[model samples]
Target: MSQTVSDFIVQRLHQWGVRHIFGYPGDGINGVFGAMNRAQGKEGEIGFVQARHEEMAAFMASAYAKFSGQLGVCIATSGPGASHLITGLYDALLDHQPVLAIVGQQARNALGGHYQQEIDLLSMFKDVAGAYVMQASSPAQVRHLIDRAVRIALARRAPTVIILPNDLQEEPYESPPRAHGTLHSGIGYSAPSIMPREADLDRAAEVLNAGKKVAMLVGAGALGATDEVIAVADRLSAGCAKALLGKAALPDDLPWVTGSIGLLGTEPSYNMMMECDTLLMVGSAFPYAEFLPKEGAARGVQIDIDAGMMSIRFPMEVGLVGDAAETLRALLPRLKPKSDGAWRQSIEADVATWWKTLDGRAHQPAAPVNPQLVAWELSPRLPDRAIITSDSGSCANWFARDLKMRRGMTASLSGGLASMGAAVPYALAAKYAHPDRPVIALVGDGAMQMNNMAELITAAKYWRSWRDPRFVVCVFNNEDLNQVTWEQRIINGDPKFEASQRIPDVSYSRFAELIGLRGIFVDTPQLLGSAWEQALASEMPVVLEVKTDPEVPPLPPHITLQQAKNFSLALLKGDPNESGMIKGAARQVLETILPGKQ
Candidate 1:
């Protein structure tokens, strides 16, 4: 008996434990899709999601991969469809995620006489993959290339590309079976670094013996090390605060976990990151150079697995290259918990004052509706089990700063590259990953519309979706790339604010309705309760679109002289029109953070 290459690929993917494939069918790829259709949903596994764009398919699959801790799969025809996968693949690479991209070729016979949709995939993807292999040129090549590609993807925990030809789609293929191979799971952690072990604990102990005004800037790597992180903070009589991504690694309500850092970071974190005399970096490599206090402003120690990252962003007196959990555990027992809590009251008072000031600045009184106000109101209302995701913009800063976290919650985002289109697909994948937990996306108007919201179809089509109908999207529809516009004002020195910054005024409610998802569009807070309540009730996907004042300028996370001037200029841009008002409000918000006052 024999089967086509397409059939063999699907069968092997199944054996590889891939239960879903995200992609759009194309000319040369029809055979592959048909083959997958034949083998799907059997033995409690394997299915497909037909995405509107190859890009979205890749995104959704990438999210699924990240959430499940398994390799994600995507299929595309050669040329343009294959090209569409680059962005998502790049995202996976940055996150160190695993993905297998299987592309359909023109056919074995059509080897580059400029055949339609032809691509030198080897050349095109060499930079992006751990491995790239085209259709088995020879019979002996198939087993090796396929096995090698799968191995590389798992080993590198990045992308592996396998290009199959149309003619080989069903080439009579047979090979003797080998022993069941090890999966190579490829997931491993480096041992905790322990150098000057006695002194490191002694140094931390010295700070604890001396005072209580110590704090931590915990990062993503701090996850699962919660007990040790908290205990170390306790030993030093220091409290803990997290980076935006570090939100999940620790609980939000804990007295020590003070929230994120830098601009759009929580007021408590801002006050503490600056106020603490000794700062400890637990598993995070925070990159915002401007946000850190002057060198030696606060004596610091950083712990990380990658030696290079020990103190790359900011200098540290003691750098430990190791796992956060192991390092923290070893440092304990030897370190003493302080008897009298020095500086805790002072730090607490300052933290309280900082949050009080931010409270007024974060929310507003007047109308046309502020985007900040919308995000502020919604963040509190979300469920305890929410897996929140955000798009980069003014809203991202707001979400990172204000969104409350519970132990059950998880948040994901595209770091610094700040891509706009990932919100919805991430939400879908979070739903797939957690299923029972609520998944919400807090997106700006420009970001929410990315990928054209077609992921709603994928959401609706899933046979078993996340419960609580909690995979809802609350979009801050301000209708402009406000961050870019803000940059134009602060750095570019543009004068009068312009309405042209608003690219489009698409009716989001209408679009959500078109997709059969519940759509709630609002202009007033009076409608928020019902809109929110009903949206949460939806059995399928829900889109709560709130029209916001486009001119609402986001406030800085914390303030400095340079920030004061930039915000002042942004205020200067505000005219009587919408953009002006936003600038004005932004400037007003900055005024509250005037130095010495905080």
Candidate 2:
């Protein structure tokens, strides 16, 4: 029997080391599904994971690439199915994760006829998969399309696309003939060792050595260079701040390692950026120039694998384009040890004070439960080597500020896109990548209602297969779009328009119970600690829901005068929950000013 183009494509993907593909099935993609069915349970065959929606599937693929450091793959049908993948693919593209999307298209003859489910997928995918996007015109083209898509996605660390016409998928496979205009592509890609020139490294070292106070910012690109980052920081007696995506790049236990940097940043981080004489940015594209050092106030040096990303955030005295770990390793020997210990001591003191302030804030009383306390309680209880994920909302503010990450623990969310509805899917993919480790996802009510609830079924379907059955999704049931609501007050000077801010309160815990998963609900702060314990110990997947107060502000590290005025203006304009908002904000502010005072 002759192998169909779909069969050849599947086999070729496995050859290129694709272990799993996430997507929803459709008639347009039935040919590939048929091929997958035939290849199932065979030696070296690829596994397929069916997601509730194509969007979630793409999110899972993006996260799989992030957590596993492998080429992530997703598939969908033509038109809507293909279009549903755009947002998630953008998440991968912006975050610099390598993902490949394969979608089925209409029959060749029906493409221009405007048949059902026929849309111009090529133009739709052009931006997200701009690194490489192609359609297989003939059976012979399938081989190279698969090869190039996989190779380029890995090489460029971005998303790639392949559009397969249904009719061509069932046709007999053919290899490119050994003739002119025919190309033969092979499987496998190895990242080459990249290093900056010696002259560049020497210049960076000189700038660092001259400065009395040095500050470092690390991002997702620095994940693999943890030890190198530490060595450089120690040599220069510099303090380090982590971008949200690089939270796990350094352990929070380090005194000088300030937590997340930006609006969700720590006071110590903001202060370090404001006060430092020299700045070194490693592998981070943390946008928000306001959170960085003032223009021309500090000498800057940057290291990144992508030349385009170098020196974009802040003008630098030197920009080195190379792998983070490799470049840092080369720069380390050239750096002269700084004798000044005063700057390091000051940073450590500020970091210590910030943690204490956070503790006071987390312990402050709310209407029922303080949102910060939920994360604060979980911080000490998180098992060693656990993986954590969070959605974008007020929940993320706590996740960024309160969660104390230890060495060996991995965590990630939709970094670049900062999209909602990604936490559950990210957790699912984390479990697939490391089935033996426990995975937890922190979500808000808004994101849970948006699309995460449906993914709980996906969890129920696959939890028992995991070697470790401790997957917990902790939902913050605040009954409001708390993040954006605050943004309205602080950024827009508008009151919380109840019509848009209020969300229907649903029993996320009960929903989990209906699907054969454990459910625990906590309405009081005292129960928060034990609830986490119960959820983490459950053999089945669990949903831990906390009835948190939406009025509690996700306060910025350093609120600007304009933000203060805007917040006051919103209150003057008559917010619906004006009393609770005042109380919550006051309690949080007082905790910072008068620590431990009720």
Candidate 3:
């Protein structure tokens, strides 16, 4: 073939530094796959990762962008394959990860007749595509559409979609200025440094400085700006609380920093939100308005790159529209250090006490295993550069609270979408992005069996690609949808329904072995460390299955009377896991009500 549209697409992707494309091959996308095969040389090589499912491909792509800070790319065929990508695409879109999705459509001639594998991809992708959603009508539109899609994804930091009809993929570029000019080179762009106006910064600083007790909420938009955020926090004497997505933005070891906010929150964060006189929201649009101070309870200064996100979460006295780091830098100079350290010290004391309480809870022995202790063991053992991904469930609660993130370590989950089955793909993408760094996936048993457990094979297939393979899958084999079970008992006021939340017991370690990867099974607390060591030593992907107690509830830092009432009802209804629920309630009461006395 003499330089088809498919060839140009691959070539442009290479130029833009997209080293990998995650997707499954299908008949509708055969033309693109064929062109991908023909591309050669160092720059021409865009690794096409063959995921078992299109959903997994989309997740891998989303995580690739998240970990590497690059534009992640995924492709799929028309109809079902394309539809399968929606959830993952939504995950990326809602979480604000830069992703480019290319979906194959039926040939132009058969598009409207509802041919086999035919779907109007543009219509299907409209909602999740963020802004750039277009079809490559002809070969001439291919390069332009691809360029715009990439630009939109990068500049907007959201997903963009390009629908390629099967016939369009094979069409030759005939209307370009020149063949080589059309398939351009040296295409690069830089994000403009966004800083708030001087007056806005001064006003924000004034509002921040005026308050006696300040609390700052940070998010992923403040990534790599840890110093600026901390500087502002220090200047304002603010207790900082990270939104779940910004869990790794600040080291958990920081005395002034509270790990996370909302339901999966720390006592310090909860108390700080309730007590703050001023709130400075740095790049976080944390959706839980209920977790924030009541309107007019605190004066707020909100800073965000997107003007739309500022002041949306909380009532703002000063809304600074700019980049988080830049705005913070400007505000820091204008802010005066607080005279009273008592407010900061009080929050610090609460944080210290909370940790001690958590340590007591995590280490306490259980029948199968203590889930919190498992996370604690893994946290200290993780390499400084380890990239951790957790499935959304009770596993997230453990990982969020117990997993102590350091300066270099990074962790993420489906924060915005709160979806499961993403941990495996996220880990794979992190490994693909930085093969030298250790990548670990913390998944609950419920999430492990969801749809794409087959993607573990993808990790096995690509094991040798890494020079030092240190990918480990830590499965919390509690044999139930523990998070949802807890939710059912506490939120919905129902006894544990075995059929809905209970999971069939699976030997995840054996499954790993069967898939041609190393497996480490841990049923006892004592074996956890050894299993982790063995996993780290293995030069291939290792799945460490930790059989934990399904009964041990993943309790929140603060418990409400409503939650307690629901649990009591469940216990009265002869809930099989009654002991755990009772114990969880007792612990919450002891921790919250009897803090220092306990």
List the candidates' TM-scores in order. 0.86, 0.99, 0.96
lDDT of 1 by residue, 1-598 (tens): 4576667667767776778788888876776787777775655246777777888777777777767767788888878888888787777766656788888777777786898888887777777774554555643345556666766676556787887776776676655344464222222333234444666766755654554467778876677688888788777877677776677777756655667777667666766777777778887767886666567777777887667676777777777766788888877776777776755555556556655554555455435565655555666677777788887777787777666677767787765345778878777767666678778787777776666366767766672544556567787777677776766655554533456566577777777778667678888866766777777676767788887765555556555676557656655765335455555564446546563332
State in Å the error of residue 39, model 1. 1.3
Please identify which of the two predictions, 1 or 2, would achieve the higher TM-score against the true structure: 2
lDDT of 2: 0.94
lDDT of 3 by residue, 1-598 (tens): 5888888888888888888999988888878898889885545988889898999999999999989999999999988999999999999998888899988889998878969987778888999995899987777767678778898899998999988888888888554556564654236668899888888888887888799999989998888789998888888888999988888889988888877888887778989999999998887868999789989899998888888887788879888888888788777789998999999999899889878777777766576798887888887788888899999988888887878889988888887898899999998899888888989999998888985368899998998988669889989998889888989888877889988988899898999999999889989899888888889778888999999987777776667899889877777788877777676556545655564453
Q: Which candidate achieves the best lDDT against the true structure?
A: 2
- Cα RMSD of predicted structure 1: 4.4
Report the lDDT of model 2 for residue 209.
90
Q: Distance from true position, residue 124, model 3, in Å?
A: 0.8
Superior by lDDT: candidate 1 or candidate 3: 3
Model 1, residue 268: distance off in Å is: 3.2
Candidate 3 lDDT (Cα, whole model)? 0.85
Instruction: Provide the lDDT at 235 for model 3.
Output: 82
Candidate lDDT values, in order: 0.69, 0.94, 0.85
- Candidate 3: 10-residue stretch with minimal lDDT: 177-186
**Backbone N/Cα/C clashes per model:** 7, 0, 0
- What residue runs in model 2 are displaced by over 4 Å at the alpha carbon? none
Model 1 off-target regions past 4 Å?
130-155, 176-213, 317-319, 463-468, 495-500, 566-579, 582-598
